[model samples]
Target: MIWTLFLALFFLETESSLTQSAAIVPQDPTLTIGSSIRVTCSVKPELNLKAENLYWTLNGRRVPSKFYTVLNSTALNLTLNNLNGSKQQSGDNLLCHSTDGRILAGTCLYVGLPPGKPVDIICWSRNTKDLTCKWTPGSEGETFLRTKYTLKYKLRWYGRDKECQEDHTADPYSCYIPKDLALFTPYEIWVEVSNRLGTASSDIITLDILDVVTTDPPSDVHLSRVGELEDQLIVRWSSPPALKDFLFQAKYQIRYRVEDSTEWKVVDDVGNQTSCRLAGLKPGTVYFVQVRCNPVGIYGSKKAGIWSDWSNPTAASTPRSVSERIAGVCDPKSGEQNSTFRRELKQFFGWVKKHAYGCSGLSIKLYDQWRVWLQKSHKTRNQVLQGDKS
Candidate 1:
């Protein structure tokens, strides 16, 4: 009976040891890139084991022999030196196993890249209230290569003895010029781009702020069917009344597009002349037209000045045949009446210009008046044509 009891006791002790071996647990699972982490394998009863046989593997691949060391027989620690927080190395499973073959534990690690670059840096003069520096998106990093950018800016005022003022940072590259910059003076601006590897600089851009002056819109905008076969349209208008003779150097920009289309084609090179022609238009199609001015000085040595607000949109349709329309209206007896009508029309325009506060309603009223005149003129010409036919 004693022998039977001994066998049962030995069997119970074996089962307890097995249960304890299975209870070994691993350390925490998360680790950041470029950081160190310690992993431990714990068992219930510490086994006085040697360090040489402790093994570590990441994702089933053995870590290099020199990268880590085994602590006591029951504990193993790893120091991932200079860890590059790359996605490929992040969240990978790391396993530590002992030669006793009974203790094993694993942990998962995570790595992350740096932050994105800053945006929308605007430079304005404190003195002139003019925007001196404006920039769009700069260069970024490659997908295979983790990358970021830094921005820097420099501002220099003419005739000032001080050196250029600059603002920037290695990370989140952006700068803004305050509103207190001197007004009515010229300033030069520059921007730079940088990354973890190197940097690039932009060419200097210069701008001038003029003393604020009262300005008015352009006047006498007229559109007429000009070309014969191709059915082109010609637009003409006088310069803004507020423009002094010295500002006559201003160049005009004409923008036009078909009424049915949303795209706006620009003629940036319209010279000092007040007229511009748009060709290659579809015959019998209605078109909308507008104009703006860019005041350039010094024969392009300086950048063009700020653009004026766009003129009121005027519309004109190409006639199918100019000769037929003119013949219907030509009458020697009606010449006196036509002259009187032209005089009245000029007076009406003058009154509108004087009283109109440049409001949208005023523009609509002008367009409506022109439309009424056109309808009346067409009816009169039709009556003359009918009389000639009879």
Candidate 2:
């Protein structure tokens, strides 16, 4: 009786293996959405099942016999109509079964839409060091899958196409190109996207490396009063980190606004220096001042690089309005030793000019020009006073 039971179990197991051996057609196919596709199930000739004995199931639901046809006793075929992205992306599973409802064989169907072309690709470089580009996903942004994006770039005249390394920026659609970039040679850039369905590429954009140069903002900004002059504020800042090697000349701009006002008054003649004296500010009023830099003549090119971001605002108030304190110190009240008084006043102004650059006095250059003009004015003033007495 035990031998009989063992043989019976063996026979059942063999029968189950045979039932599951039917070959499902197309074996995990990938196809486009809205397109029609065929699937088939077949078995060995000796084990061929009659059409009435065979059936199919999709995602655990019975497939209607009306959608299938029997080609022979050994083969049955099913046709899917208007395949959708959901079916493709999820890899819908199909199974062949006996009429009694046991699974014979199975296959997963892949149906999804290909990624659409990327759009609006644009790029910029930071202080001529690295290039960064970003784009918008194309084709309704629905690939029904986790699509991958890549940035590809190359020089117009040299080098092979290269892929940018993602430094893990917050923007997934952006890519950074680092190191050994050409400043004069134009670069072509684009984005490529791909997934199981298909791949698409964005339009190519070309740009000069210098044209997109932006750098870290000027740092260590400071503001202070200019001597006793209540209408002047001196602004100073250091160069950006990327430009600190003294490899290029940088032009600077200074702008200021009153604490209670939004209007900014920009100084256009700060030139390439790192310091500027701002005059004509309202005495005793708080002013907000900022500085920006643009590198010029780097790499021996005449083009001026793009401006860096504005430095953080530095606040300072012009000194309260005061009468001329130096007038008493440098002036001879009764014109005694008039020649000696003139020399003393000149000496006093010279000392003030030396410290003026760091303070609110006119810039050193302006101070020199000022002293020359003052000498002419002082000589004329004394002559006129002496003539009036006579």
Candidate 3:
């Protein structure tokens, strides 16, 4: 019985020794790039580890002995300075190895660059139903890791800070706020950016819904000639679909460029009209035109709101180039006195055929009576008076 008990104790000790392995202190550390770090590997006392037999490997390569110190026979310390983001983020494995080429223990090191503060934050709402905010990233925008941006906002008076879920904006740095908007209430908005390294926030921007109600870009922009004029074209477009039902006066702006030219000329005095006559354009030249709208007096607002995005461009050409005399009209356009007289006569006859107000009948009756009187008089009174004076 004593022999059997000693044998059982011996088996237990062997099993424990076989199971022993090196372990890392502060396993799997995460740190900022360029920061210094230290780690230790330790084994059970029974393993009889030696300082000369232990070594370190980083990313499948052996680490120099100058970077480590032997704390004791079973414990080895490794130090790394000036960690880089790319190397650490790629799951750099730091392993404690024995001289016999057996990996005892290992841990992954994660080094990253922190996000910088965001800048140039701008927010706008569409018809007061939704708000969108965009921003430029802080210094060194690229952090090697995927960065997350969240837009947070709250009413200035009372409300819990809320995260914006709809961030599918055209600008990558933008977020959408969809609900719980008040026209009169001012809102405080900001963006928070985070990554594995660290997090940063933008400065808070406060604004009212009405003051920033910029509508979508204008659509279905149409272009046509103004009457028969050669140098003029009329540009027309409808209000944004979201703001059409809202009571607001929209002022339009027009810019045009020749097909061959890269510069654009802006027409700033379009006022609140949906259609404006563009005069002084080159005749017979294809031109590209764009229009944008600024909504004013929205919901009886005394101040003007922001301008909407420019409409998708549209193209139009002026009347065929005309002789300098006619200022770009169709060729053979009435330029002479006879042509003008014929045009007037055609207009007169058109009036007679249309709404003459019985004036056509009156003119026909007077024409026959005047003919009969002139024939019966035999000579004019003015002619006889001139003959006697001679």
Candidate 4:
């Protein structure tokens, strides 16, 4: 019984394959957009089907009967005009169905335009190591078909063309070369995009690995309050450590924003300085600061390196104004006490600027310093009065 069941399955599979092979004529024809074609469906004499009994459907929707033509008793023709591009990348399915709505035969129609030329090719290296390149697709970039993108490069003066193994996790139009990049020699890079329609190439861009190099963001970014300056903060950062061995002069940029604001104020005049003084800020407010670096003239090459990513944000707050504190804390009715308090407060902050560490100019030591200054100021005032009387 088992043997008989296996034989029955084999016969069914064979009949299915034969039925598909003998049905659709010009099976799976790829035509260009706006083109027209006449596809024929022929039924086997044994199926006892008539030409008028067969209907057509495309992508599971019924085709209009007006487009059908009766060729013979066992054959029918479908005339499609002014075809558009396939709705899917896998091409559109056209099927011939029997009177019972059973699918008899099927084919795929490929309709699309050739890819346009790739443009705006750019390449850069990270730490003079593996290179990466990206390009913009030409025209609409949508061919409505399966398309392939390849990044090709070679040493400009020597060596053969090699395909850049694409990193799938990267952007769809970008590729990465992890290692084995030449430093001094110029390299030519371009991209080629292709599909069933046609292929296109981008303009070749030639660059040296050393010239197009970038580095990691500036490290060890520290932001602090400027000494006794209510409206300024000082931002300092270390250079990108990886590029120190290379011959390059790196420039820096600093940007900062208040704690409650998303708008950033950028300082562009920092030049090559590792430290910059940000002025004209709201006092008593915390600010977030970040820095980035650009290496210029690397390896004596004239081309400027790409800017590194901005460093992680570092936070610090400008010192509160002495008047602001006095307005909130001092007793308004006591004129003498208020005067004496303001004087001691000024002296305390001045001393904090000179000697305080890690207190943001408002240390617990401030009260002790205020007491000492009060005692000294009274003695000095008395001595001056005695001198005046004498």
Pick the TM-score winner. 4
Please say which candidate is ahead in TM-score: 2 or 3: 3
* lDDT minimum window of 10 residues, candidate 2: 322-331
Question: Which 10 successive residues of model 4 have the least lDDT summed?
Answer: 13-22
Error of 1 at 74 (Å): 8.1
Point out the higher-scoring one by TM-score: 2 or 4: 4
Off by over 4 Å in 4: 1-22, 329-390
* Residue-by-residue lDDT tens digits, candidate 3, 238-290: 87887877634777788989999999899978887778777767768788899
- For model 2, residues 45-133, the per-residue Cα lDDT tens digits are 66556755789888888888899988878789999899767544467888898777767788887777788899988777787888878
Evaluate residue 88 in candidate 4 and report its C-alpha lDDT on the 0 to 100 scale: 85
Model 3 ranges with Cα > 4 A deviation: 1-22, 42-65, 70-75, 86-104, 113-119, 137-148, 169-172, 192-201, 245-247, 260-262, 300-304, 323-390
Backbone clash pairs in model 1 (N, Cα, C under 3 Å; residues 3+ apart or in different chains), count: 9
TM-score per candidate: 0.40, 0.52, 0.65, 0.78
Q: Evaluate residue 60 in candidate 2 and report its C-alpha lDDT on the 0 to 100 scale.
A: 84
> What C-alpha RMSD separates each model from the true structure?
15.7, 14.1, 15.4, 8.8
The alpha-carbon deviation from the true structure for residue 4 of candidate 1, after best TM-score superposition, in angstroms, is 56
lDDT by residue (153-269, candidate 1, tens digit) is 224542443322333343333444444455345555555553333445555554444422213445677888763432578899987765535455777888888898999988888
Ranking by TM-score: 4, 3, 2, 1
Pairs that collide in candidate 2 are: 88-111, 226-360
